[model samples]
Target: MRIQVFAILKDFFKKEFELNAKLYTIADLRTHLSLLNPNATPVLNRCRFAVQDEFVTDEYTLTGNEHIVIIPPSSGG
Candidate 1:
């Protein structure tokens, strides 16, 4: 699956990237990501995920090859 990251996450993750794993849910994706990018785990936890252009909970299951949008909370002055 491809996780499209934006905002600060894009910078952390070096823009968009592909993930290949046996992940079954958003929670699993996050866990897998943490293991792959431990340095960004703190910020990763603050991110929200969306599938099929709609916001979804972490428990949402991924059947495979779903392109997920990773949107992190934006900061402002």
Candidate 2:
């Protein structure tokens, strides 16, 4: 499975890198992310989670074929 990093998430991640992983749920993915950066948790919790562009909840299960993208809410003029 692969997940995309967007907006400020890219900064926290240090890059817009693809995670080549095998996580089954959004919560499962969170655990992996927490290991990488403690700063990621609050953002991860508030962000919109999508699989192949459609929004999904944290309980949503992942399929190997989908592309997951995490995007935090943006505020600007």
Candidate 3:
């Protein structure tokens, strides 16, 4: 699956990357990513995932070919 990360996540993953694992749900992908980079777990937990420009829940299923975006909380003045 292809993943695009933003904000602080981009610091860890550098914008985009691909994972070659069998992930069934958004929850699964979250766990897998945490395992890949434990340091990013806290941030990952707070992130909202999006597919096809729509936000998805943890129970959202994945077909393994979707382009996923991981968006973290943002604050501005």
Candidate 4:
């Protein structure tokens, strides 16, 4: 699956990357990513995931062909 990351996540992973593992759900992907980069776990826990422009829950299923986006929290004043 192709993943696009934003904010602090982009610092750990690049703006875009690909994962060919068999990830069944958003939750699975989250775990896998955390395992890949333990330092990103805290941020990943708070990140929101989206597919096809719509926010998805951790239970959301993955077909392995969709382009996923990982958006981290942002704050501005």
Candidate 5:
């Protein structure tokens, strides 16, 4: 699966990364990602995840062609 990142998530990764993983759910993706950057766990826990733009729960099933996006809450003055 190809997952994208924005805001805090983008900052955490700094650049796009690909992993040959067998994840099939949002929770699984989180587990896998946490291994790469343990410090991101907390932020990821509060982040909103999307499948091609539609927000979904952690149990949401992931597909091969789907692109996931993880974004943190945005604030403005």
Candidate 6:
């Protein structure tokens, strides 16, 4: 599955990238990413994952996706 990095993550990852991880759920993806990019781990927990344009929770299993979007933390007043 292709994981899409966005916002601050692009900075942490030094540009978007993808992984061929055999992950089952969003949590699994996070774990994989942490190992792949420890520098982003600290803020990863606050990020969001989306598949098929719908935001999914940690437990949300990944069935299929051309690309998964990882939205970083957003701030606003």
Clashes of each: 0, 0, 0, 0, 0, 0
Candidate 5: list runs displaced more than 4 Å: none
C-alpha lDDT of all candidate models, in order: 0.86, 0.78, 0.93, 0.94, 0.79, 0.81
lDDT of 3 by residue, 15-34 (tens): 88888899999999999999
Give the clashing pairs for model 6: none
Root-mean-square deviation of Cα positions for candidate 4 versus the true structure, in angstroms: 0.9
Better model by TM-score: candidate 1 vs candidate 3: 3
The CA lDDT at 67 in model 3 is 96
Question: Mind giving the per-residue lDDT tens digits that candidate 4 earns over 1-77?
Answer: 99999878877898999899999999999999999999999999999999999999999999999999998987767
1 versus 5: better TM-score goes to: 1
Poorly placed runs, candidate 3 (over 4 Å): none
Displacement of the residue 55 alpha carbon in candidate 5, Å: 0.4
lDDT of 2: 0.78
lDDT of 2 by residue, 1-77 (tens): 66687888887884445677788888888788977888888887788778777888888987766677887887768
Query: How do the predictions measure up, each by TM-score?
Result: 0.88, 0.78, 0.94, 0.95, 0.83, 0.83
Best by lDDT: 4
lDDT of 3: 0.93
Model 1 per-residue lDDT tens digits across residues 20-69: 89999999998888898888798889989999899989999898889899
Which digits, one per residue and each the tens of the lDDT, describe model 5 over residues 1-77?
Answer: 66777776776785555556888888888888888889888888888888766899999987756777787877767
Candidate 3: worst-modelled 10 consecutive residues by lDDT = 10-19
lDDT score, candidate 1: 0.86
Two-way TM-score contest, 1 vs 4, winner = 4
Lowest lDDT 10-mer window, candidate 5? 11-20
